[model samples]
Target: MTARTAALAIAMAAALATVAGCGRKAPLDTPYQAAVDARKEAERNKEPLPPEPEKPVADKRFILDGLID
Candidate 1:
């Protein structure tokens, strides 16, 4: 291959290697790991999950009369 093409290929390979190395998950995976740890902790503590709140029923007449306004 030509010298210019060889140099370009080397540069591209180096750039790809740098990006691949930079993409390591040790730093970015902390939050997910923490979440998993927290879930396990909650399970260990035998904490029950909170109940869902009840939604209010809409008053159709009040809405039509603009009483909500």
Candidate 2:
């Protein structure tokens, strides 16, 4: 094939590949989209996820109010 024709074909292929790639969204596109969706679903169901951690328990044993040691 002529050099000019070959160059044109290569250029067209590259352009087509670039255009094709533009339509794909990476799994992590929004990063937190999955978390947001899960939160919405949990809110709708009025249920907390099992793996969620609870706040630390406060110490109620007793503490000296005004001790200096």
Candidate 3:
């Protein structure tokens, strides 16, 4: 093969190798990702998600009483 043809073939091979190396598993394969997907599936099935504790709200009456007393 000519030098130019050999060089072109090498370049094409290198490009193919680079592309072949880029195959990756989907994020859903990970535990955290699986949990996220499961949560989404539960929501789609209308299952209630676990509730978070409510944050405390500032009571103006308590604050005012504290200030007065």
Candidate 4:
């Protein structure tokens, strides 16, 4: 089609994609939950449970402490 029509279609598609990603209350925890479920299954089967993943530390300085000195 014409250049103007093509540009308008691209702009609308971009806007639709941007809006579609909004409104999530929190990120998915599927990986962590899967790990927990695996551990439970292992326990039921009398096998060793894998170690739980560490929760993220919220402190900004936790990362900077090593580099600061």
Candidate 5:
């Protein structure tokens, strides 16, 4: 193929890749939910329960922090 045709092919491939990557992403389940699911699955299989997931700590920023910007 001509150099111009090869360059066009590469450009089209890159554009297609960019468009594919822009598709909507799936939402992830929270850690607590994941732990619950694991517990349920273990119960169904008569296996030992897995360790609980740790709770997320809340940020302790000062009240005035929210006033900026």
Candidate 6:
């Protein structure tokens, strides 16, 4: 094969590798809710637990405070 074709192939492979490595993972679960659930489950099992998380700031906003969800 020509050197030009070889270089092209290598460059393409490098770009593909970079793209694959850059894959971003999104959070699959809500941390606040998860914490709340954990606390509840722990209490149910007779284990001592800290107070549950308070309502999120976003939920306490007024209608005119910000854009609609």
Give the Å shift of residue 64 in candidate 6: 20
Among all windows of 10 consecutive residues in model 3, the one with the lowest summed lDDT is 50-59
Query: Which residue segments of model 4 deviate by more than 4 Å?
Result: 1-29, 56-69
Task: Provide the global lDDT of candidate 5 against the true structure.
Answer: 0.87
Among these predicted structures, which one has the highest lDDT? 5
**How high a TM-score does candidate 2 get?**
0.35
Per-residue lDDT of 6-28 in model 6, one digit per residue for the tens? 99999999999999989559766
Error of 1 at 37 (Å): 10
lDDT tens per residue, model 4, 1-69: 999999999999999999998886885767767788888899999998899866555556576689876
Model 3, C-alpha of 68: deviation from truth (Å):
78
Give the per-residue lDDT digits (tens) of candidate 2, residues 34-62.
66677678889999853443445665654
Local accuracy of candidate 3 as per-residue lDDT tens digits, 3-69: 9999999999999999988976654375555566667787899997644334456556665687767
List where candidate 5 sits over 4 angstroms from the true fold: 1-26, 53-69
Cα RMSD (Å) between model 4 and the true structure?
7.4
Q: Cα lDDT of all candidates, in order? A: 0.69, 0.70, 0.73, 0.83, 0.87, 0.84
| Total backbone clashes of candidate 3, pairs 3 or more residues apart or in separate chains | 0
Q: Between 3 and 5, whose TM-score is larger?
A: 5
Residue-level lDDT of model 5, residues 18-53, one tens digit each, is 998995588787878889899899989999989877
| Model 1: CA > 4 A from native | 27-69
Which residue pairs does candidate 4 place in steric collision?
A: none
Report the Cα lDDT for residue 52, model 6.
Answer: 72
Q: What clash count goes with each model? A: 0, 0, 0, 0, 0, 0
